[model samples]
Target: MATLPNPLPSLATSGLDLPPGTLVDTTLDGTWHEPLLWYADGPPADLRAWSRLRAAGRPLGLLPVLVTGGRRDQWPEEWDLCPDAASYPGDHDADEVLAGYWTEYAADEVAPEDTGPGTDGTGPDADGSEGPGPWPGLAPVPAREAAEDADTAAAGLAGVITADADEWLGGARTALVPARRSADIPAAIGWSGPMNHENDVARLCAVLRSWEDRYDARVVVLGFDTMIVSVGRPPGTIEEARALAAEHYAFCPDNIDQSPPYDLDAYAEKAVLNQEAWSFWWD
Candidate 1:
């Protein structure tokens, strides 16, 4: 994957004002040649920590990302990052990657009886309506205007998560990584959070990049196997959400199949409609 010249190695000597932090290079294949990231040793209890980090890091080509250890109490060093195993997010097309996964995993699972129009001639069955085909095309961009700018929404969401870091992140700390865009942060760090579902995280990042353009979404927090993004534009109605649900299903089937209310309609109504933050977990 293409990457910028790592500045982490020079962080201490470069005279950037920063809190005491640790530079991480630990990966699956021993230590990496250059520092992959630098994370605060202490929890950023202040809500302004993210914004502060962003201001300080942006000029140096370092982007901010919240890293959670999850239930295992593991930090980045224990997460087994593998930068060499990742591909560039821009290398793949979003629709193609999503359709490929839909064909492989969703085609066989969605039976005709489960998704046809209601018997009463209304639309969508009682359980949950499915789109015309297995890989329903990408959801349309919301017609309603966004509540706020994408970056602003991201900063606000980051503050919310940081405020309750222990409860939401298992004491995860804020980290600065060298990434071209927010969507590429995971692939930049070689996060294997979705390894069970997709080994190449950049493919999913491609979908995220598409979301960044269409919905004004930004990657906010990442855990061992979960990701939460802040959406500037969210569907305003059930119909719009139902359409978006198809993409979510393809992106992470476990978010629907393994979770309660295990139907697209329910998942859409509860998770997508007018919601600013979208969380995905891969089982």
Candidate 2:
């Protein structure tokens, strides 16, 4: 895969302010030829650590992300990461990848048991369209009327994860990945967090890049099979929320199918509408 020059090897002697950390090269296959990321040796106890670490890495082309060990102690090294399987993010088109996933999964019959409260056993959703309908296409970029600074939003959510982590992300540690932007952190480290949903994570990163441009979203926290993103600008109305919901569904179906209110409208209302952060889990 094409990549920017990895500066991890030079981090130790680079004279940049940094906390003690470990350079990780372990992968599912074996040791990688080069280090993928560097993570602090301790938990992120300070609320400002995320922003501080991000600032330190920005000049060196390393982006900060929160890595979680979860309750099971499944840290990054044990996550079965497969950087080798990933292609460059630039190689994929977000709309194409999302549209393909939409076509592939949108038509599956929603089993009666999967239906949620306020949802009919079978019929049109609040949006007047159902899964069997044509792909809704991409949502237009929303106005940044209620937006926060992207990094500030990320830091705030980092504080939330640090304060409330345990079941999902309490084991948060600040980590830095060598990448040009926050959206590419997953693919840069060869994260396999969503392998079950999509084998090549760079494809998902492309969608993230699109979101970064449209919504000022940043990759915040990553666990073994989950991720949290901080959104600067969220949908202002139910109409816009439902449209964005289709993109989220295409990105990660579990955010809808396996979530409560097993339909687009409710998921949009609860998860995507006016929310500053979004979380996803794979099965």
Candidate 3:
């Protein structure tokens, strides 16, 4: 994968006011060619610290991302990161990726007889509670004006999550990564969080890029195998949310099927409709 010139090595002399932190180069394949990121030793006491880091890092081509050590006790060092294995986020198309996954996995969850044209699987016995069928297309963007700027909403949501880091993140820390965009943060670190589902995280990032453009979403927090994004514009009606839910199911089936309610409509109403924060976990 192509990359920007790493500035992490010069962070000490970069004249940015930064808290004491360690530069991480540890990967599964031993040391990486350059430091992937720099992270503070502990959680920030307040959200101001995060805002400061983000402001300071941007000029130097660095971006801030919240990193969690997960309940299983995994951190960046133990993440087995493989930046070398990731493709650029811009290389793939989001709709194609989601559609592919939708087509491939959406059928598996339902019986072969239950899946076909005109059957959406929303019926009570269908896998998704909606009738099971071929991939549904992307969700429509909300026509209503966004409640807030994407970046501003992301910062606000980050503060909320950071304030209660233990409750939301297990034990999360702030890290600055070198990336072109927030959606690329995971691929920049070569995160294998969704390895059980999709080995290449950039494909998922592609879908995120679409959300960034359509819903004004930001990649706010990342856990060992979970991701939470802040959406400035969320679906305002069940019709809109139900459409969005199909995309979510294709993106992370576990978020709907494995979790309670076990129905797409319920997941849409509770997780997508008018909700600012969208969290996805890959099992």
Regions more than 4 Å wrong, model 2: 109-131, 144-146
- Rank all candidate structures by their TM-score, best first, as comma-separated numbers: 3, 1, 2
Q: Per-residue lDDT tens digits of candidate 2, residues 133-173?
A: 56656788886564568889888888888776675565788
Alpha-carbon TM-score of each model against the true structure: 0.91, 0.90, 0.92
The clash count for each model shown is: 0, 2, 8
Q: lDDT (0-100) at residue 111 of candidate 3?
A: 39
Per residue, candidate 1 scores C-alpha lDDT tens digits across 30-123 of 9988888889888886888888888788888888988888888788898778788889999999989988887776655543443654211123
Q: Candidate 3 lDDT, tens digit per residue, 1-283? A: 5678888999999998777788989987899989998888888868877778888898888988888887876878888888887898899998899889877777566334333343223333334544465566778888889977888898899899888988987887888999878899888889888888898888988999999998999898887788999999998988788778878888998987689877677787899999999999998
Candidate 2 accuracy as TM-score:
0.90
What lDDT is reached at residue 117 by model 3? 40
- Model 3 TM-score on a 0 to 1 scale: 0.92
